[model samples]
Target: MSLPNDASEDRMQMMTKTERFSKLFDELERCREDEQMQKMEEMNGLIDEMNEEELKSIFTIELFDKIHQIIEEKTLPLENALVLLKHVGYYRELKIIYLESFDYSLLRERMKEMIIDENEKKEEINEKILTDLCECYALLGEDDIFGEVLSIIVPCLLKVALKKDETEEAQKEVEMALLALGNIGYWVEKESYGNEIKEIIKYHQEHQNLTRLAYQSAWEFLIKRFHNYESLEEVFVNDLHFAREARREIEELKRDVDWKRKEETGKEAKELLIFRKWIYNIDNYFTSCKLWNEEVEKLLSSFVQMIREFRDNSKKVSNWCFFSITNAAENRNVKIDDLLKSGAVDAFSEEMKQSTLEDKIVYDCLYFFLNVSRRLNEKKDDEKKEAKRKSIKRKMFEWIEEGYEDVMTSFHAILPDLAEKSKFLQLSKYSSDYLWSL
Candidate 1:
């Protein structure tokens, strides 16, 4: 009698759990049919109530297939479909299902229909859905599909981004759109869409009401898409403007470097640090590109002068200046004669004498010297090439003559370790051979 009663209680408990699960599914169905946020929230609550084990048991592939079928049938609103997708673990479960059964045409049509439908409801914009759709298309890795989606959505995003009298909510919408476009822009062919995207971003940047976030996103998109100097000329020009400002600030800070070095905790020091970062970023930009014009030459010259003045004050600034010189040398933009004439070689030698010199600084120095050697080797006149090589070798020895032993000791200690890293292996070999010969 006791065993029968216990079995009866166990069956009742199972029935109660099943009943609760059934009610939750019914609520989900209602939410799917009527795209109501409140119902969606309640559904989320129900999903949250279940532990991981219970969730795994209840939200199985069979139910997921049913939701996918509902999405296919177009009976449920997309938002509601997405909500159901989220409940069933959208990224974890749905992504696997879609990727395994990758249907390009079906997904493309659905995306097109959704965008067209959303455009029809202009006042009631659903940018989140659209952004998510862009992300989804990006993940699909279908260039044509991504391009098609971008073509449709970018204009709409631009419209929002360029809207007059934008409220805060509208601004947020524009930001979302720009971010999505940027993400999509990274994968798509730049030639097809870069100009239009740049134009939209330029408008956002020029607008007084727009936030810096939008401008920055647009700026990054432009930089990433267009690699040519002509296309990036505007950014270079902006960098020049900032560089000018920094130069002026650095001049002001130069007067106080002596006072500030002692304390290194005042407004002057702070301002100098900020200016140094600006200079580093500016120099890095020039280093990254093949912008070897007269303007860049002038910039390099200014950097040399800055190095000479600031060498005693800031190691970071000095190191960046050396890096810029090294990069210019490597690119064959700054000739060895000009670099030596600018006192850059002397400055590099001085910096190397410091015990606190980083491995990167040593590498840059070796890279610069290697580039100089290569340039000399490339000369048509053998006599002139040998003469120039001997001159550079003599200059290197002269610079390190005071602490040659110390510099060689440091090199011996660091070179073996640097040789183990593939990037610096060649430099390590050349420097080690050069030092031993010297």
Candidate 2:
């Protein structure tokens, strides 16, 4: 018979039995297409007689034999061989067989040598192979295998990607690592695996790009894992703020070129202004010197006048009027009456009376008032404390009455029984302890 072309000859030489069987099926179909029905029938009959398991066994054996032949001939391309094996589902099986056939300690030592090599090429080669392995296991519904592969590869990828001398190639690898981590975060329930993911994010926070991605991941992860959130710890928030600011700057840059520039610029300016207020908390702290304070007051008064002019001309109420009152109370440590008398809180209470109590801005004003009140309360003298004690007692009584009314409304259906039991019911000792502690 004539020898096949070089490419086909090479492919045949490297073909495992599994690949041979797959090729046979391909050939038989090609034959049928060419009107070679008799030969196709014969092949189909043979294929039909064997079930999937039997075909798998025959394929595995043939692949093992073919692998040995290619090894002996030294003609096989490792990547091609692996790709063909995976196509036929023999690759992973062969890996298990090969590892089991080895003295694991020797295999491990060799792997260690490969990894510890100072040559970047060798490290890249090893990591690519590892990443491929992980992809295979992940695709095959082997989570434990995938997790194990990642646990090994992530640290190595991080090391390679973080190195000062790493090329753009390494940065691509870092991006891939983030993508892989994101996948892991998706597949695993946040509650079960969030801490481990958070630690990985914490480590990546050293890199600017990685820090932004990490916090973005954590934001989604936290909402998924926990229903309620309070303050992010100061250290975490401060570090994450860098990433947040970077993202904001990037969005601003993009907006500058886009059609939404004006609108987005305004939004960015507003956000940054709000963040400035949050960061400096000037209204809360009031630490500015005389000249600075005078400048701020002048600027604020100008803005207030502009808003009032707009409101009066339009005959619409300004929502921000109460803000001046709250700011005065917080910064000057003065009562609402004192601020109103000084004309610092002009038309503010009037505007507030027209607004709904449930408005978010109103709640913000109330919270600011509460903060101011608590601080003022902290500075109370003995005589003031005595006066406040009666006010506190009256408030406590009102709270108890409200609580009782709510409970009665909720269980109104059981009124007669509830009434009979109410007299006999005493607060449990544990309930008293818990209430006292609160």
lDDT of 1 by residue, 1-438 (tens): 569889865765566343555555555545535545555555555554444455556555455456556567765566665654434332222112223222333544565667666656777967677655544433333233444456666665556565555788877666555544543445445456555555665554456555434544454445544443345545545443323433444555556555455345222233343344345445545555544454555556777887776667666666778887887777654556666656666666666677676777777776666676566555355787777766765665555456644564567666656655636336635444435132
Candidate 2 lDDT over 318-426, as tens digits, reads 3343443345555443332333233333333233344334333333333333443344344346887656644543443333322433322333343344334445422
Please give each candidate's TM-score.
Answer: 0.48, 0.26
Model 1 alpha-carbon drift over 4 Å, by segment: 1-128, 132-146, 149-160, 163-186, 197-213, 228-288, 294-328, 334-348, 380-413, 422-425, 432-438
Clashes of 2: 2
Candidate number achieving the greatest lDDT relative to the actual structure: 1
> Model 2: how far is 222 from its true place, Å?
9.6
What local lDDT does model 1 show for residue 394? 66
